[model samples]
Target: MLSTSEMTPETIEQEKLYLDLGLSEAEYVRVKQILQRRPNFTETGIFSVMWSEHCSYKTSKPLLKKFPSTAPHVLQGPGEGAGVVDIGDGMAVVFKIESHNHPSAVEPYQGAATGVGGIIRDVFSIGARPVALMNSLRFGNPGTGNVNHLFQEVVRGIAGYGNCVGIPTVGGEVQFDNSYEDNPLVNAMCVGLIRHEDMQKGIASGVGNTVMYAGAPTGRDGIHGATFASGDLTDDSDKDRPSVQVGDPFMEKLLIEACLEAIQSDALVGMQDMGAAGLTSSASEMASKAGTGMIMNLDLVPKREANMSAYELMLSESQERMLLVVEKGREQEIMDIFAKYGLEAAAVGEVTENTSFRLLQHGTTVADIPVDALAEEAPVYHMPSKEAAYVKAFQQMDERIPEVNDHADMLKQLLQQPTIASKEYVYDQYDSMVQTNTVVTPGSDAAVIRIKGTDKALAITTDCNSRYLHLDPETGGKTVVAEAARNIVCSGAQPLGLTDGLNYGNPTNPEVFWQMEKSVEGMSAAAKMLETPVISGNVSLYNQSNGKSIYPTPVVGMVGLASLEDITPSFFQETDDLVYVIGEAKPEFGGSELQKVVSGKYEGKAPGIDLQVEADRQQQLLRGIQAGLIQSAHDLSEGGLAIALAESVFTGKGLGVEVDLAGDATVALFSETQSRFLVTVRPEHKEDFETTVDNAVHIGLVTNNDTLLVRVNGTTKIEEDVSTLHQLWKGAIPCMLNRKA
Candidate 1:
């Protein structure tokens, strides 16, 4: 690893080749002309990076402007650090999902861990108490040793930070594929709770406002994160690992408490977390948004090392730091508060009268660029687009209908696929008990938490199965969206909004681009059907390595509204309740679990979508549960009806189920059908629930005996005690360890 001191002028020039730098002849002439009006290189780079499409909303900004972020229930949205939704009674919830794809691809563990740490700050920087943390991780298949190392390290990194910070890692999505072997995507989502009045913004106003640097001291780590993220990964990306910051969760925990306390004291006017673009980007953005100017003496910034260059000090993506525009006289008070936590704090600069960003290093001016020119005028380009040609893989008819001599043993084997098995091993590493606000934790379909002091609760979940998407982008995307919404609805919540992290391979490839286009269309259609607008999302492209790309993975993070009185957790409480399927299940075996279990081939087109059916079923189920007509609900996914039934039984108070599928044995058991839900309704309300839901089918009744008996076409396929079922489901993924090469 190269030290920061070794980064000479020649090294800086060498690094420039990896980024576009946006310094075209025409752009340079335009910038110079603007500089003729006023000149500053540091300010120019800050503005350029912040307003760049990667930082600024130049391209997507105009489009995102159309979203309904500020509804009647919205306490804050868009321009703020994170979106805040009013949860009634002066309480609100803040949530946002961000991508750190480029960095994580270079250095998986630290890159991912720091990504989590950064987003957590984004929440608490706004005076909110981060309640939960979730990550959507996409990587290349772990069949290869190196890929396995990256996967294990990334998981450990997320676990390490989340656990250390005392925030529960409630839920998330993980997928493996070839495209991501080299360039993985690590997108983290954080949700915070705060009082409506406590919410803060990233604006620096009032000429006398003092700008303070709080948290860890400046370092050379992640010097050009924004530019790094905006570039494509190549075989030489290992050399770019220095651009990924090393995380310090201990420092971050202290920072979170100190910042929240500082905001509570009414000493700070505005605040912003030092993420991606770090100091230069955060300060310039705060000033630009406030329509004011800022004058910074970089020399005053507390540093971990001596003799730092102006650029190094300005753009360093140092972890766990924040920029705060304090009310002049209260700077010392805030500094004292941070100091009590053993964290560093210093007054770096002041808000200025002129609308330009100014920097003085060692009392000498280095750069002074116009705020708007640098912050809002970065270039935006529309890339070339093309359609992907569909080519079906070679199919073997004989392997499709494998002889299952022992149906019970085959079901056990199928349950053991890593994708369908319990994620206890991973969830166990997380601190799911942190804030005492977690209403529903990891094992449930969706995690629910109370909105502090309010009668309302919020349900959240992230969902995606990339293997299905790689086989069929359109259907796979739609199914995942529906599944996420279904999970939330199963908890008796009305779906509110969505945040998507679209992870894909190199866009330069026509085939990958085609997958992306199709996936987006699928997601758009699903969102429309569900009436859930995507409020915030991220696009992660070029998730490829060594000339191979992973499957198209568009991870959907959804939030929904539920009153405390109506919350229905996924666990079944009564043994005698009737189990029902909310919608009809068809024999959609295109990309079914049956295909993976019967034949080792994992390629095939996913199931088709019936948007109307899905929407109607979801709506009916939500109404029934909210009306207290049902107690338990779970969505069908991964291993389909059989797995769904098994999971419901495994979590029930006592599981004895007798179900008869009115279809073919294999098709009725393991088909990857959509728009289906397994719900347990009271014996008396079972009839009413069926009537309420348009096409709900009463499959069986839960019994006192802890055994699961599934009869298909008069054949008893699975007969296992609840204890055995639980053991099998929980041990499924662990069993895959035996198959690991």
Candidate 2:
């Protein structure tokens, strides 16, 4: 066993050992003051992880308070395993988004696969059955061989876990940029369904309750992972690969069924997933929340690796493990349930009346500390924040529109850009129709899933544009939220609420802190205007490598409610349907795909959004769709009008469009003006659709020509067969991934 003698206070003070564990000298002093004595090695490990930003949110709690987390429909928000929102009829939806960025950068496959596994446990731990899984992924330029490999492995990892667990991998978004070259972001989200009566909290109340360990046996993998994730990645990050947890989806499947069954029994008091800091966080936080304490006998804990030290067992983030507090007399019942699934369920300890977290091994006390000191009293800092001067300078710069010599060629090039290209190469490997609840699969504005035995359905999506946030954090933040709302509205669902994965850089950097502050302000404004409250979220800071940070990529995961009968498709439904643009297209090219394609970089202001206008347009679009006046609806973003129009026909449906737009050819085709959508209305309902949708402009007609024909001001600008465009879009990512460097 690892010895604690080396971690004595004399040696620690002499060597400043806490610095190696990510604790500052002041923090170590504070720990000494709190405990009124020097801590042993196990206690120090507990403090290091529990105080980490990944586990404590010490640096982000103040900023997170800015998000409005409560609404009438929100039953539980922000502080639970996942947020729960009332979906009417005694049913609720639980969902949250989490990032595994640093781990994924070090070990792509396992990092991403365990991210999916951990999120699934979060949902099920709250007694909800996970219904769907989605991901928002960002990687560096795909032309780089290393980036391609990372992208491929991340996709496979997501697919492998979700498919094996029999949950549908639904709609999501992906963006590629050089800013993510060294530190790719892998954010996973899971949506769950449950009855209102089955709601559970991770609180260990009722003194003398049995503390039980369930699921997989603990191992040494993922030790110190919380602290690892809280720090910046460096050239030596690959050495931390051992901190990435290996996941077994089959084991998770069994645990899910077993735990869900166990929750139904009255014996289960509190249950929490061993994620992040693992058992230390789960046990201490659960006890702290209930104003109680726990005395765990580490010798009784199940272990897959023999002779594991108490500290290793406490900190190991082994996948598929859970901590449960049960009614003392009824522990046998819960044990039987877990045993039925061929899993471990042992009585490891008991809840205590005193407010302390104590660990014992081999008939000796290993560590003892105040429960609140570990879980509730992590330090909070309002970091210094300063807006980058370049933000204002860029916004004031005159528009630098690149002259397009051949509009058709430019359109083709934008379509081939990795950020705008098709993602069938990724989603094709996922079983998106698992459990048969999927009503609309991927390749749409948002995914729609039907609620069995009811007319209700849900529209789900994940979205972010990090390049815009890189240029202007505030505007880009609002745009991403508005874009998520547009997608939900386009799928014929009323916006409900959202979860966020705020992945940023070191909080100690004033500029990065300012980006986080401004971005949250923007997202909050848009969410309020759109009436979508922030239900749950996670913050991932310090996403840097070698002192260079990644773009401020705050991903939004949104869910909306709809009637099964009113679901709208994002593709053309019939030939000769009248096509219209719902909002104005401006010459807003900053942070646009066109700019990136032209200059190989993005500068200038990110596009501006009037939240009120965006909200009004979204409501209009949803009303039109629900009133049966619109046939097909799609939001214009990223590659803008040209990409949206092309995507409507890329489903190999043999449908196309002919449009005559009066504007600059380049701006009309490629400008990424927000709050705009491409919609088609049947000729019979054209007048009503126009009346219902404000700012609607008739552009053309959907046709069976299988060709996309466009004329700008009586001049042919773009003409291409739908099949040809589809081929280029589909082959881009796969070809890049398979090609040699």
Candidate 3:
């Protein structure tokens, strides 16, 4: 190993890796000052990745503070591998969402698979058993660019990892737009169960305790991925295929079980998954979090490749790997647990009293830095931001919107819109019933998974409408959170908390920074009003191509506490059931599906949210669900009342529906209003349900005939066969994809 004293300008000039690693001139100057001189090659590589925007959260941390990350039932918050929340009976739910956008763009299958693999490890690293998985994927329009290939492979990637790991892919979301043509977003969310007492903090503690490496042997895969993720994609992005970490689900399965067993063996101090910056992230973060230091010998690491440099060993983002800090005498005991599962385990380092990070190769110091300075002291910037010009343009375009001629025709068109269409074609490929605990799988308001051996159920949903965010970042941000909470409550669950994945363009661009700022403010206000804290989340910046930013997509993935017995189906079940429309309706057509189908427009600020009214409506619905008065419930979104009714009937078991409204046919049927839902109850229980809720308008009845009929003031406006609506909605995406292929 060469020291900085032995390194000279010739070697640094030849490599000049700083430009390729996304390190700016100022950053390199800072690194030199931190070392009190020029750094050798290995030291330079370590600092560049650790201090990167993807690893350090430099630009987004200031905005993240706007979120409310703590609640009374929260067992763990944002700083750990994942957030944990107590759900009564000494049980807790652990969950988080992470992005693998850049890697997925280069190698869709491997990138997406490792995204699922990494999030699952985050949960089990804290001593939880992963029970359900979900993914919110975004791609270019089906026929445009490489969308079809990206779409098909990304799905296969998620299925390959989740199915093999035996965790059910319960629920998630998928959206298509040209904005994501070059840089598709692959966000994976995993939920796990653990007893509150068994949850482990990912920290390095005890001065003499040994640090062990477990699971797969290290290799030179996905090196500098943290740096790769921080940069925007370009035509040459395909050449970075080596930065995509390959996944091995079988190894991950063994790792999850072995880690859980070891956590309960009373032989561990701390544990964490080696994700992102890999060993560099895990070791530095563990040491930083505990106010301690770690000294590691590169020779002791289990590796598949021979003659690897110290730099490659530290930065390789190898999949299915973990770092464990164990008690002084329990090294072999910990080794025995993983060895039984056929995994490699070795003591590679030990905790120290001093707060320094040191790496030794064959007993010679190769790299040394302050642990906190490496993990936590990256520079934080308050980027300049202002409202973008496009927002005002979208608002002004409203005056040119055209009128709708036929309500029935408009309903049919909106149904065929890809975002609003049925996703069964996609979810059917997933093994959603693998765990046999999935009470309500895909094609529901929220996916509900029953907690085994208990009467409790956990409801989960992830949502974000990029058009809304693009039109009005503040309102769109608030709407995303509100929609997630609405989905949870509609399933008879009280939303406990939420996780977020904030995807945007380069934050150095002031216009993009403005969107991020406004969206966070909206999410913070909504979370406080709904009393659901944001427990865990990931931030994905640099989602742009050729200087064009994608929509400000900050997805809100929410979890709620519910009971299996109280869970309400989103379909109309019985004939003669009375359908009630709750909450007020306004004609706000900013980002509605109707705008796309009928007018080809995206205009106006987002439909504003009245947080108190939204909160009141959720509580009222929950009360009705508990009292056994509400039979079925579904929130009104996208195409509004019209699409909601059509979807209510499109379910194979639904009989039919007839509605009589009170306003202009277009406004009454297609307005993208907030805080509204279509709920049904037996005709006999209608009186009691109406009494319990405010603003409950009886607008429709479930009939025996399989027809979707609508009227305004008893005049026929929309009339169509249920099966006709079903075929069109179900076939749109598959047909488009097939034709494109």
Candidate 4:
């Protein structure tokens, strides 16, 4: 272990553990020159860490300016704790996604729990009542003990916090592979509801305004968190576990109520949560956004432990904490409300007119930095682009045919695969019914929630299958976009806009660069076809561990517009409707589940894309549903048509059907044909539904008897009771979990 005396600048610099601060060679020299006039501790490691890329967005800040965050319907956007959009009728929706990659790699459970905790606070910080929560998690294969432990712990962590906080974990996606073994990516998103006029901004103004700290007391935990996030994890990260903050959902629960109540009383001017960078970031940003300054007295801060240093108080990422800017006279009211909840509230600072951030301890100045230079300015880089080599390689591949024996068993095994199985166990722990706005819950193509007053509702879904993208980026990317849009269409919604979280390996490598280029091009092409533009997004690089990188994962978070009248839930109704397969299923078995199960390999190419046809199909499906011609709809995705049919039956009241296919066995069962939807229509409207789409095919009808049968070329190829099929489908997940040992 290194001693305090030996923890000098040279040693720390050698570790490459300091924030870049977005400083140029000359600007850095200038900062050093200015620091020479300050005390020793003023130029210490904590200060530098707080000013780094993870905290300051030194690299991404410039590029984020190009996003269209604000629209006529947007109540609030960038610079706030979370973005708020006007959902109409005096109501607004607050939503945002944040990354917790480095910390999760260091300590999976606590890291993931705190990530959920932090994002919830972000939504509630702006006076919004958090209603829904979601996460997009990527990890290594679960067959390994360590990876399995991480996966289980991370899932439990999300459940523990979100469930306790009474916020429902509505929807999310999980991907497993070798690349994320050591460097897992855990991105959490939160959505909340608030009145449009009551939304709060985290800004500090007025020379006499009082600055207060509420919730938990400051501690040494999570020191230099921003710097820790920016650096690559190594074998020594086990020693840094203490740097990961601990979460307390009980305290967060109380804080949420207190903050929301305080905002309503007009006693608060600005508010922000002390996440990642803690007090330093919250206070500096609040003041900077208001074009003002602040002077924080470290000695006056409420601390959990005695004798805390000024730097520790500023940089600590202790959970359940928030900073507030209150008018001078209303400080007592704000303090009383927090005190009643048995929470600590202290006036540790005061807003200043001078445009500089000042820190004070024991009535003596510790550090002073210009607010404009430190808060608003961070470096942003437009990275160089390159052509992906895999694109051409996949385009040159020849399709190979796979021999099928007992296609029924093949379908059962594919549905049982961990990736394609039901995630009910995970979502059951979430409070998805909290706000009473959810129209359709988990285990669906997309989640639909009412917009409260209007006849309009919103449909949200997150999708991506990186394995396909890994095999063929362009097609994989296009499929993801197409599938997400199809999911919305299945719910009777028109695709609106998209937000992507691009997870990739080191971009400096040519192979990784190619993946990025192809994925983006594919996404762009699909987005144009769907008529949805990329709005807000995040890019996460360096997602590799143990010398291996994860597949190019560009998880798409899509939002669509839907009318309340035409909303179609994922589950089918009673047994009298006709079930139809709406698109052609071709015998293109590249990169398919049949290949994985039969061959134990992943070398085949992914499905191809026909943009025009997909777009037309989407529009036709929406028209059909809106006209009340289609009763229910579900998109065909993972595990192909067989799995889609299985899930549809499982969700319905009962399964009753016999599928008669006009195609080959493999093509009829396992082919993941895009733009295809399984729909249920009343026998009377069957003709209208058939004519709604140009290429619709009626394959079967719902039945009262609990049996599923498949007929291929006039032969009964597969038959099973509904209960047995359900057992097989549900058992797949637990079986895979038990196999981990």
Candidate 5:
């Protein structure tokens, strides 16, 4: 209810400035005590935005610390713009995923566009050339008119920015559900390549260094954007339109080249992207990290609008802007680089020896506050938590997984469901091959991008099932990481590092907070045992609308590494190739797609993770690929055995698969078992494959005919044409989204 208009010119009270700036009373008192006086208008604005939940991670920091952030291959972890891992041969990969939820719900196009722009900046700011981009999108049913419009616009926004910037939108995931009806999530992930020595930190080191600003000019747009992201979307969300920053991909393109070139020139000390809290976060955090201070002049900054005040310039989230700390006497060299790209690089500030950040407007001091106090001293709250009653009931439910009466019809129904159906209609619009490094495109188990010169390659995948999390948060969290790792490892790569996008409902709700705590604990335990340290990630809370919260969705975006010779395709390659099942199938049906399709419910217990078994399977698969034994590999997830088999044959024409299964019908076909894989080997290498891969079973072989058949214990259970099932699987999503057959 406290509005900025309440603070009038003549009647303004210095003590109440934080209230108008959206800070809690306790936080205001803390600010006052830190400065030993009531904060001035400019100082209040800076602290308010920097200390907000979105920029400071006040509530989530303690939970984030539980994740495994440091591994042997990790060069830099959580504190940087994006995590960096040494990927061998003196090259490293930089990547991260962040959310732009509330803004996207209000203004889909600009919100989504800026999200892409901001992440790209994060990558290049660390002195890396962004190679690939991916997004994890969730919405209400796109079949409806209103939601369909939003879905289309968000896709277009992503394409417009990524395509124009020339970063290939390689691979991502999308699902339509009612939980996202009013508050859709648009999470963006970007991966970049850089030499190990060229990797830079976003720190402002050295006293008396020259500080500069470049790219787009400051404007009235996107004022208070960071604070807006810290809160929930309400009925008045549309009125916050001015808080969303507009993006210009062309300008961003120039900035990328200029920054990369300048970094190579070795004239810059540190660089930070002007995202989130805009100038406030980028400047204060950099100086604080470097154990330095700064004095900035608002008048020297390039501004697109006239008569902009100090508060507006300090907090505006203008797109395509960056702050650079350059070495002394090389200012012109840095300026000339950006100027060559037609971007203005103006001297805006200088690093100081004092430990305070001082602001100047027209040679007059406006705000002075301690650098570390503003960036590192936010109030971190340990939220109150209580487990929701519904969670226990859902987990303890006695619902039965229906019998496999008609396996063929059941496969078709599961294929048509929104979650299991093909997403070609959505991926078709993205430019996945622009950079010419995409080895395996969107339809595969995980995306593989070639490292142009070296024999090395990279793999990426994202996975999460909200229903499983809703029923059992801890298990669902562990399963998501396991699933993502399985996809990457199945594609014949060794798990290297991970980046997570944690999406949940309002954190203030005790039930929601409890879910968050449990999920993080689960994810942490799994990461440590697997040794896939979580290098970089993001947390997005307050994902509810109209008093309705979404199911817990903690999306894991993982990256893996391998030599080009180790990459494996996820498809049926040749006739007479021996088919084998790796890892055992259990009677686990909790949170399975079969339950959703047949019983119309999300019930049962989630499958528990056995770290030793999971680790053995990953090593076994990696060894097989290294030994050139695996002809093709794909993990069994979601629809379990049946769905994975169908997908393997979905892309091939005139190719059929025949498999013999002897087990419980439901468990063998659709049990949603974890850490299992379907693999094929050359007939000649069958002996070595079985000898090398433990717990492996020879199932059947690829057939040359058009008919796909499955027999359980010598009895035919599923018999259908490959083309018939392919049509239903591939056309489901297109039909729904385009409203056309």
Candidate 6:
């Protein structure tokens, strides 16, 4: 068969092949202008994947710049393999979050498994040992057979890879909604530990450094994966199954150990993971960062398939592979390190002073281009943006409070809504305590991991409420970031920084563009106010199935710092402890769990927040926790105060609460006002707690009695046994999945 190089520019246009490769006519013209001639087949393929939205961030880059990414402890922020932050005692924490949405939609098992594998590579490539893993998953109604199957496999895939790799899958969250019926979002996050002195970068410096290929062999699978991920899913998307990668965790385990060992050698200069655009991106970016060039003999790349073309070798998104730039004359030393791990390591190219990326196959020059053009010169567009009409309409609509005739029954049903229900069924499949560094497990506000030798620990969490963003993008954005920080604070930690996974719909649509723009603005303001700078992140656009788009879900993966002694529990500790509610609860039910259950859809304005108020309140609550005043602390979300109260009770020992709430019982229990918390204080420290946190309102008392009782307006509004509430809350998801189609 003739290669793409044999086709003339006229033939390429007649066949319209570039359009099939996710390139517009205007982009094709720009490529030709950059080259000063028509690009051959392999060169065209390189340009196509490098310029795709999945790799280039052409539309979102301008918006991303608005985020606050600097702080005193931030070692490295944005534009790297993973963000790094100093955690004291010469150690740093490295973390990042990325999405594998399109591939997961077509092939859930392999797609999710490779996503975990890929993110792990991102951490260790920078000389860090990944200690913990977290995920944020979004899917459709759990009762449907298709959605259940997808959810089951995605969880299994994550457990399979992470369990085998020996890193703990500590914590994460799962939300269900019909907007994600066809297109699901699977965002994976990896956090690693590193010594500042051992840190490495992904730069190919030194004119004569040898470029090495390590880990798995190259194959034809996942050839156009980058371009595939940049586009929307259609009914025919199943045809793109070849773009989904297969992963081997055992091989990755070997790679991780070997890379960590190799990083100790002074001969190693730079390293990068072969993710997204694969070899093309890894090579170009490494070279461009060093202001150097590279020349590769594609024939030297270890291939699993016979007679693979240059294009396939460059663009393959093969899992568990990495690119290394080593000093000349020390290639043998680096190769020997991988040999100890039974991995294929070979010298495939060399860094050059020529400043161009040149590729050769079978003694023939196949592709040659300026490295910066491929790495940094991709076209960026400020797509047209206009406020979504639905936002204004929803804002104008008055809030509708649901009439709860049976308060006890409504509490039971609200707890069963999959969005607010327990995720024990999902986390049970994961190995959360593998390394034994996990101090706090899956059921808390944030997962806490302790540094072995130091007294310090880290609190990590992933959060977002997409339904709120659907109602009001800007307010929802601020709410998500603040909520993430609140989770950390409740765990008795100081907010460090965050990594974001911005998952949105097609940005070409003006309304969708506006959502992205406004959401970034809100998140930026919150981050600045809370001092949780945006460190490293990824953006996944074009999350559309057919002509419909999912909610604008921007997931925040944040980490916080604390001492072991400062960590507080998320459940009640002692009987008769005084219970308090921090921050005022308002009749803000828009995009709330009650609204979803009653209306079966979302409407009305999203709950609003004052950034300064949230920041000040968090500081006060944290101080009380540090002073040993709090017996337990839980953030109010999803099902509102009632659900949070039930969770605090059910997840703990057989303890219950007797609460007397002011205002209408329905609004008091179910209104999801932002920046509120349900905390318990010891009886002896009650006065000190109230003094420390001036806004904390004494609302109830923890009791040995196994019943949750709520009184309002001198009348008993709700009273339920704790055992029944726990059963409904814990069994909702499993019960739905057990139903036969």
Which candidate number would show the highest lDDT if scored against the true structure?
A: 6
Give the whole-model CA lDDT for all candidates, comma-separated: 0.77, 0.92, 0.89, 0.76, 0.87, 0.92
Cα lDDT of model 6 by residue, 24-138, tens digit: 9999899889989887778888999999999999999999999999999999999889999999889999999999999999999888999999999989988999999999999
TM-score of each: 0.90, 0.99, 0.97, 0.90, 0.96, 0.99
Q: Which stretches of candidate 6 lie over 4 Å from their true place?
A: 1-10
Across 32-117, the per-residue lDDT of candidate 5 in tens digits comes to 79999777667778888988878888888888998989978999899889999999889999999989887888889999999999
* lDDT head-to-head 3 vs 6, winner: 6
| Runs with alpha carbons beyond 4 Å of true place in candidate 4 | 1-53, 56-72, 388-392, 435-437, 450-458, 472-475, 494-498, 507-539, 560-565, 586-591, 603-605, 610-615
Pairs of residues clashing in candidate 2:
none
Which stretches in model 3 have alpha-carbon errors above 4 Å?
1-10, 13-16, 395-402
Local accuracy of candidate 3 as per-residue lDDT tens digits, 21-77: 677778877877887767667777788888888888999999999999887899998
Superposition error at 145 for model 6 (Å):
1.4
Model 6 CA lDDT for position 717: 82
How close to the true structure is residue 94 of candidate 5, measured as C-alpha lDDT? 95
Tens digit of per-residue lDDT, candidate 1, span 1-741: 445445443443445421244444455456657777422445445544665445764434433443345456666655667777766677877888888888877787898899899889888877899989887777664556676677777888899999998888887766554556677778899988888889899999989899999989999898877766765678787777778998999888899889989888777899999987899878888998888899889989989878888878887898989999999888889989999999988999999889888889877877787676666556554445565544244122222433456666767776666566677866777787787778888878898887666688889998887777877787787887888999999988988777777777766576776677667778877877787666666666656666777677888888888998888967666877888886666666665666767766565457667998899889989889878999788888877787887777776467578888777677677777788888888998967787888878888888878888998888888898878868877875444433457
Q: In candidate 2, what are the lDDT values of residues 533-606, reduced to their tens digit?
A: 99999999999888888999999999999998889999888999999998887888899999988987788978
| Residue 574 miss distance in model 3 (angstroms) | 0.6
| Candidate 3 local Cα displacement, residue 626, angstroms | 0.8
Report the number of clashing residue pairs per model.
6, 0, 0, 2, 0, 0
In model 1, where do residues sit more than 4 Å from their true spots? 1-48, 51-53, 57-70, 391-410, 452-454, 471-475, 508-518, 599-605, 652-654, 721-725, 735-740
